[model samples]
Every structure is written in structure tokens, then in C-alpha cells.
Target: MTTILVTGAAGFIGYHLSRRLLEDGHEVVGVDNLNTYYDPALKLQRLQRLTAYEGFDFHRFALEDGDRLQALMRERDIRVVVNLAAQAGVRYSLDNPRAYIDANVVGFLNVLEACRHHGVEHLIYASSSSVYGANTQMPFSTGHNVDHPVSLYAATKKSNELMAHTYSHLYGLPVTGLRFFTVYGPWGRPDMAYYLFTQAIAQRRPIKVFNHGQMKRDFTYIDDIVEGIARLLEHRPAPNTSPLTGSAAPYKVYNIGNNKPVELGRFIEVIEQRLDIPAIRDYQPMQPGDVPETYADVDELIRDVGFRPSTSIEEGLGRFIDWYTGYHQPISVAP
Candidate 1:
């Protein structure tokens, strides 16, 4: 079994991914600072589940601590490194831009450094669909130009791709970057739009419909995302020579998404149907640093991994609501 290190191990996606890896008999070393960016209680709960696995190990630290991170890599002899930790949220970046830089940029550099020195076989990190900011493409493709990022969060993700490429070129690091679409499911982040909408609707409160209900999202289920990641864990990228730089960097990027865009209004209606309650629609204009639509082109992901996210919103939301109701019985309004 491969010894893999997953950063942000207590996060929504990271927790799920780590559990999957452990189940697959891989020795997983999990790292997270348990930061207060969201509820630490939820993070702890996820960690508790992972701790039950015999193959799982946990470390309480942030990626910004380069010395400690390097030490951990050396100690564990980590082969595959999955960097999923980041300062998430596009709107939050407007007010706290520095947090994005510190975590996404500086922290990522430490991850790259650790992988470069630790004989890590493959370096897989999370990128976001937000990097396609201001691009009105129907289905966002990795080959499409992503140089015009509207928000600081997106800019940081783009910077990660560039930084990863630099390391791959110089050190022959096998780097794979995943640009995730709107991922939603049980044990998901409370700050995401889906979770917020579900909470509001359950409490008989108004749910804010952004872009006047004109926005569309490629809402990928969490299971599909984790499945794609599991497949790619062993499918490391090969060196592809670039004529511009004359460097054959073992680097690749793929979009892991549903490849189907659902309207914001309809998405809420599904939630309402599941909750058996009608939502008070508070239609709002598009927020700053927000786009009207996000659709993913998962052609490369399918071609390489022979997998595609096919979970429909109806079925995926049904499972999520089932878990949500059970987990949050007697749900209270969020502060």
C-alpha cells in the first residue's frame, strides 16, 4: 500500500478522500491546522471518523510551516502528496485577500518544496473552476486560457497551477492539478451555497437566489469527485515536452465535474422538494467576483482515467438530504 499524505485532511473533500484512501488499504498521513475559517467542530467530527481507520494517521499543523512539513515528509516517507488545503470562498476573498495569499500561495509553496525534496512520486493539488473567471465559455476546458481571474481566490488558484508547473519543469515532479466544479454533499462545507440554501429552507427562511436566478453551476456530487480522485492517485502524468520552454514537465490538469450545468432556481426547487417546504426566494443581483455560470469540460479526465461524474442532482441531493436530516436533527438557525 502506498503511503500518501493529504493536506487539509479534516476538510470537506479532504476528509472524504482520506477515508476512501484508507479503505483502499493505503497508509494515509493527514494534516490540518483545524483553522477557524469554518466551524472547527465539524472538522473534528470528520477527523474522528477517519481516526477509526487502522491505516490513518493524523497531524495537527498548517502547511505554512515548511520546516515541520518537510520533517513530516521525511519521517513518513510519503510517496504521494495531495494538497487540498486552501483559503476557500470567492466573496470572502474580497474582504480578506491576504488569507488567500498566505494559505493558497505561501502554503502551496511549502507543499511543492516538501514533495520536491521527499522523493514524492506524484503531487496532486486542488484547483478550482473559479480560475475561469470572466470567461464566458460554455464548457470550461483546461486548454482554454485562464489568465483573466476576476477574484483574488481564483488568482491564487491560477498561481498554484503556475507554481506547480515550475516545480515540475525544474525537478521532474509528476504534478496533477484538479479543477473542481461546485461540489456538494453530506459533511460538506457549511459556507457553500448548497448548504446555506438547505439550512435557510429548512428553517422557513428566505434563500438568496443570486444573479436573479440566472446562474448555472456544474454541481458535482462529492462521491463522484472522490471517485475521480481515487482513480487518478495511480495515474501519474508523464513528461510532455514544451517547445516554448524546452522543458518536458510531467504535469497535467483536468476538470472533475458533472459536465452538466443546472440552474440556480431549479437547484433550490430540488432542495425545497426534498425538505417538503417552500423557500422564500430572495432574488439578488449578481454579487461582485461572481460569474453567471460555470460548466466543466471533463473530456481529459474521462480520457485519462476512464471515469466521468454521472450523478444526477436528483439522486445526489436525495442522498445528501437523507444524511443532512439525520445529522442535523432539530436543526437550528445559523448565526
Candidate 2:
């Protein structure tokens, strides 16, 4: 029943989250620039689906436009803001560092300001597991200090956490940041490894296996992510009362990931099984801005939200393959 705003509404996670909110009877206002970071066709298709819902409203604009964003938020009387929009992809950040700053950093600041001035009740934004850069810890936890980030993308996300904390401390904003692990599902980003591998296998092309196929990821499904966000929307963070850091700011951060980590080789095997196509493996050195593993510790997420992302790679990938084959029928393998 609340009027909620979702940035990046045409992106994979944003699209799914917006649909879920609409299905739950909430008035969902979605915003996206629909940039060519990926195929605009896919983004348009996702928006097409959302347009069917009566409760869903769409706005096409970059969040970096502070004035327009402020006007939209104030006009809509946005109660909750879910910031899922950003210049994603760690490797992409290397070639295009400015995009990360413009979208992730500058754009996020606009969102924070809008929320602060608009009297928004709750603000939930996306952080990433990549923030645990260079840390060889088994399960990355929020309690662990994430001072070191290997990529510009990770650094920006960490910066977002810092910015959100500052807003909470200064303006008494109730803010929550969810550090997402490897999120994948239907209508997922084509830039992700699984999506790329699927395309390669379908074309009988050699798929690049970085670090000689040695990597691990906690692949969380889209449903689990949307479910976590839905739960958190109702459970806003209260003022911090921890004696260790006695600042009474209403801020919290949680890792929303499947505690289970799957090896890169094993992940590819699942794709091959579902596709019935043997992958031509092209083993390569580890790319820069890449990590060997990402395992999220969801203990606090479980304790606070009473939910855990339990989607297994097998099931999640199977569902993704189903959607992929159906969506991209007569699969196009253009260079």
C-alpha cells in the first residue's frame, strides 16, 4: 500500500524486485536510464513486463540528475527507496572508472540527499560482496573491517556504505545496506560469468576459465534476494545502542547471500549439464579487479530478518537455463 521507489528498475534485480512489490499491492515507482551497458532490448523487455501491472509507474532518467530525482521523489511522496541502480561489473570499472564515479558515487549521493530532504522513512541500498577485497576469510561478515578494496567498483560500494552511515548519523535516516553476493537468476545480467558461459557453450565456442578454473562464489537466486528485501522493507533499523560504538544512528548492514560457495569449475559443469553442450574451456590468468572467492556470512541476516538465502547452484542454474533457452530461442551468437 506504500508508494515505494526503486532505482535501476529495468536492470535484472531491479526488474524482479519491482514486479514483486507490485504483486504485493504496493505502488511501485521505477527509475532507470536504460543505458547501453548491456543490450537495451533486454532492459526494454523487462520494463514491458512491469508496465502490465497497474501499480507500477516508470520514469526514464539517470539518478545523477539531482533536480529531476528530487522532483520525482517529492511528487510521488516516496516512502521507501530501494537503490539497486549502479554501474556494475568490477572489470568494466577498470576501463570506465568515470562511469563508476558518476553512477555509483555521484548518483548515490543524489539518492541520499533526496531521501534526507524528502523525509523518506526507510532507505535500502545495494552493497556488494566484492567489498571484501583481498580478504581470504572463509565467510565474509559485516563485522569484519572492509578497509581494503581491490577494484574501483568495490571501492565505490564501500564508499556507499560510508555515505549511508554518514547520512544516518547526521540526519537520523533509517538506512540499511545489503551486501549482496553473486546474485543470478532469470532475466539476469548478460555480463555475468554464468550468462557468458551459457552463450559460449551454446555456440560451441571456448569459454574463458579464469585462474585455471579456480574460483568460488555464493550464487544467490533472485527470488531469495527479492524475498529478503521484502522482509527488510517492513523491518527498519532502529537507533544503534551498541556500547562499543555508542553513536545512536539508525543504520545496519547485512550480507544477503547463500552461505554455500560453489567452485567455478562446478558452476560451469551445472551449466553444461543443463545445456547438454560441452564447453570448450579456455583457461586464462586471473583478471585484474577479480577475486578468487566470495563467501557471505549470513548469520546476522538470519538473526535479523529470520530468512536465509538457501538456493543451491544446481536449482538456481537450472531455472536460469530454462529462462535463457526460452527467451533467446534460436540463440544468437554474434561477435
Candidate 3:
């Protein structure tokens, strides 16, 4: 079993991925700052679940702390470093730009340094579907040019890809960036649209429909995402024979999405049905840094990993609603 370091262990994706790794008999070291971007209590709950596994180790520290990160990586003999920690949310970045620089840019740099110093075999990190910003392309592809980002959050993620490429080229680090689509599932982040939508619907509050209720998103399920990462954990990138870059670096990027985009109104319909309630619609203008739509081209991901994500919107929403009701019991969501 290989020893792995998973940054952002308490976050939605990190927590699920780490749990899957531990179940497969791998040793895992998880790190997180537990920032109050949403709720630290949920983050702590995730950590608590992970602690039940003997093979999982927890570290509560921000990734920008280079010294601490270096020490943890060096001491653990981590073979694969999955950097998942970042300041998420496109709109949140508009409110607090400094958080993006600190967590996404600087924290990522520290991770790259540690991997370089420790001779990490494979470096896997989270990139977002938002990196496809401003592109008129129907389905986003990793080979496509991602120079026009609409939001600071997207820009930072794009910057991460470029920064990771530099390390891969200069230091021969085998880096793979997985561009995640709008992922939703049980134990999901409270800040995500689906999570909030579910909450608002349950509370009989107005659910905001952005883009004048015309936007679409490639809402990926969490289980499919974790499975893709688990498979890629063994599929490290090789030196570029024909990489997106001219430099011969073992770096690559893939769009890990459901390859299906669901319109905003339809998504809300699913949530309302699950709650058996008629949602009070609140039509709002698109916020800054928000995209009109996101569609993923997972041909490359399927070809490379021999896998394709296949979860219907209804099924995924049902699972989430079940978890939501259980988590917040004694509160009736009867429509």
C-alpha cells in the first residue's frame, strides 16, 4: 500500500477520496485549514469520519504554511500528493480575492516545492471546469486554449495549471490536473448551488435562479469523481511525447465531468420533487465571475482511464435529499 498525502482532507471531495483510499488499504495523510468559507462544523464532521480509520492521519494546518507542509510530507514519505485544498466558489473570489492568492496560488506553490524536494512519484491536483471560461466551445477540452477566464477563481485555477506545468518541466514532476465539473452528492459543500438550492427549497425560501433561469451545468456526482481519481492514482502522466505544452514534461489535464449539462430550471425541479415542495423562485442576474454554462468533453478521460461517469441527475439528487433529511432530522421538509 502506498502512502499518500491528501490536502483539503476535510473538504467535500477530499474527504470522500481519502475515505475511498483508506478502504482500499492505502495509508493516507489528510490536511486542511477548516476555513469558514462555509461551515467548519461540516469540515470537522468529515475529519471525524476519517479518524475512524486506523490508516488515516489528520493534520489541521493551512497549505500556505510552507514549513509545516514540508515537514508533514517529508516525515510521512508520501508517494503521491493529491493537492485538493483551494479557495472555492466563483462568486466568493469577488468578495475576497486575497483568499484565492493565499490558498490556490501560494498554497499550491508550496505543494509543488514539497513534491519536488521529496521526489513524489505522482502529483495529482484539482482543477475546475471553470477554467474553460469565456470559450464558446460546446464541450470543454483540455487541449483547448484557456486564456480567457471570466472570474478570478477561474484565473487562479488556470494559473495553477501553468504553475504545475513549470514544475513538471523544470523538475520532471509527474503532475496531472483533473478539471472537476459542478460536482454534487451526499456530504457535499454547502456553498454549491445544488446544496443551497436544496436547503432553500426545504426551508420554503426563494431559490435564486441565475442567468435569468437559462444557465446549464455539467453536474458531476461525487462517487464518479472519486472513482476517477482512484483509477488515476495509478495512471501517472509520462514525459510529454505530445503534451499540451511543447516542453517534454510528464504533465496532463483531464475533464472529469458527467459529460451531460443540466439546465438550472430542471435541476431545481428535481430538488423540489425530492422535497415534495413547490419552490418559491427568485430570478437573479448572473453574479460576477459566474459562467453561463459548462459542458464537459470526457472523451479523453474515458479513453485514458477506461471509465465513464454515468449517474442521472434524478438519481444523484435523490441520494443527496436522503442524506440532507437524515442530517437535519426533526425538521419537516413536507411540501
Candidate 3 per-residue lDDT over residues 1-335, each given as its tens digit: 98899999999999999999999999999999999999899999989999999999999999999999999887988889999999999988888999999999999999999999998999999999998997878898887889999999999999999999999999999999999999999999999889888888888888888878989999999999999999999999988887335689999899999999999999999998988888999899988888888899999889998999989999999999999999964574644
Task: Estimate, for each residue in 1-335, the C-alpha lDDT of model 2 and write its tens digit.
Answer: 99999999999999999999999999999999999999999999999999999999999999999999999988998989999999999999999999999999999999999999999999999999999998997889888889999999999999999999999999999999999998999999999999999988987889999999888888999999999999999999999999977779999999999999999999999999998888999999999989999899999888987999998899999999999988875755432
Model 1 per-residue lDDT at 240: 79
Deviation in Å, model 3, residue 179 alpha carbon: 0.5
Worst window of 10 by summed lDDT in candidate 1: 326-335
- Give all TM-scores, in the order shown: 0.97, 0.98, 0.98
What is the C-alpha local distance difference test score of each model?
0.93, 0.94, 0.92
* TM-score between model 3 and native: 0.98
lDDT of 1 at 199: 84
Tell me how far the alpha carbon of residue 220 in candidate 1 is from the true structure, in angstroms, after superposition.
0.3
lDDT of 1 at 147: 99
